[model samples]
Target: MPHDHEHPHSLLPPEPALRVKALETILTQKRLVDPAALDEIIDIYETKIGPRNGAHVVAKAWMDPDFKAALLADATAVVSELGYYGRQGEHMVAVENTDDVHNMVVCTLCSCYPWPLLGIPPTWYKSDAYRARSVREPRKVLADFGVELPVDTAVRVWDSTAEVRYLVIPQRPAGTDGMDEAALMALITRDSMIGTGLAIAP
Candidate 1:
């Protein structure tokens, strides 16, 4: 899902899921691609890793001020300490959202993302409309994602690049002081880390 450029979306028809299956079938028939490898890759993202991984990182940051400081300073090293850094996540930056500021991330050129901490990119993250609209009209774009900020809160859009991917550390929600890190993680959504959604309330 990572690319580096304002490359136009593929003209492939709207039925990409089916089209991909057809292509995969053909590649298997010709023995050009390994189905086992494909399955493994899919399974890895679906089960082994996903937003929950990032949620854990976020929850820890919410609980530990020192850790949060380290994360904001250098997310790569802080996350790597938990063994979540590789591939498209080589360079990482954590953007914290405050009471008066809301942050949103978009890859203007590509779907550059931190796959280790956040897993593979979501389907919409790879859409051209999102890439084009996020920077231009972030508040409106966020509203479409069901995120409506207060009138006084300033919206900050972060454009992720191949060199450095940004992760939004959404503000910790209220009524969570009694909750443990693991419990708090369950309230964190992938979109929250992507700056497209907010953490769920208890």
Candidate 2:
């Protein structure tokens, strides 16, 4: 039931649901929606349309001590320095993930994501299923996403409200002591900022 896309609580209207269901049924019958299309869409959106601003911020923070300090102190000003400021990001905080704790974000009500950096919210992220389940069973929800935290690690759930949005600055992975900015950006996934995945080791 958790995976069901239809429920009275869904924000989608009945007409849209019917059309989507019909399309899904047709797609299943014809096998028309290519599996690779999903990845292709993601690639286009992330690389072409989605702002690389967040990755830029992360790289600068890693390389410049003063900028990093300013970012930790006030993310908005630091972001504006790169001409990446936006309505949602006007007041942002870069929470650093550590060994003792992990962070995950949820809106609890609507899907309030860092669109200037991450682009459109993923379908799963906007679903009522995720919104309800995240608060009720955060660990389980995270585990379902393949993010397994240690038993002793505390999970901090930051509910994005109407006023503020949050982004996580995942700790730089090891074995990349001398990696440059471009290479480092390749390792920063949207999930890392959302706190659902750790940055991969370069």
Candidate 3:
């Protein structure tokens, strides 16, 4: 004879926020360091310390037609082509921005970013204000970022979920007729991919 038995599934309960708060309280009580310093350190690490690999990828795509085709077809390979492949960006897709269609990226569920190319996402990108406001008012958000699109331009927003990530390949600016690769790279800023700023003309 057999008897019905139940086992507790939640052997270890989930208390991520509570644990974090407890650790934070302990640190604060100990006067380990200023809380604001953590933010500054993080900012410095992401911007100054980390690799600016995304700019390199963007510049490469702009300069090499074959590389651009490879990048658009398979971003991971293209990124690896320049020896900058990694965890989040093991997969990538290069979306081209056209005259009539503009591209923007957002991660609604979490800040799943393409770290291999873009490096660490900007602070504003991971902010709750940006997450909530982006989907609600995309055009307005773009406007707030000083990106004025033509009235006829259709804004296409890509939500970066768990599996997929995207990067925008802005159209090369006019007057770069004879600019070389190094010169072209100077025009590729992170803001350009986000559609907040157009590439500077050479």
Query: Rank by lDDT, descending?
Result: 1, 2, 3
In terms of lDDT, model 1 sits at 0.88
Question: In model 1, where is the ten-residue run with the lowest total lDDT?
Answer: 5-14
Clash number by candidate, in order: 0, 0, 1
Alpha-carbon error at 146 in model 2, in Å?
Answer: 0.9
Q: Candidate 1's residue-wise lDDT over 1-202, tens digit each?
A: 6355634334333587976877788789999999999989989888987778889999999999999999999999998998888878889899999989988888889788888888888889989989999999998888898889999999888887657878899998989997998899999999999999999999
List the global CA lDDT of all models. Answer: 0.88, 0.78, 0.77
Candidate 1 vs candidate 3: the lDDT winner is 1
Total clashes, candidate 1?
0
Instruction: Pick the lDDT winner.
Output: 1
- True lDDT of residue 33, candidate 2: 77
Q: Which ten residues in a row have the lowest lDDT in candidate 3?
A: 3-12
Per-residue CA lDDT of model 3 for 1-202, tens digit only, reads 3334533323223587766666666778899867788789678556653335677777777778898888888988777878767767777888988899988888988898777677777888899977887777888988787778889988888888766778888889888877877788788878777665677766
In model 1, the runs with Cα more than 4 Å from the true position are 1-32
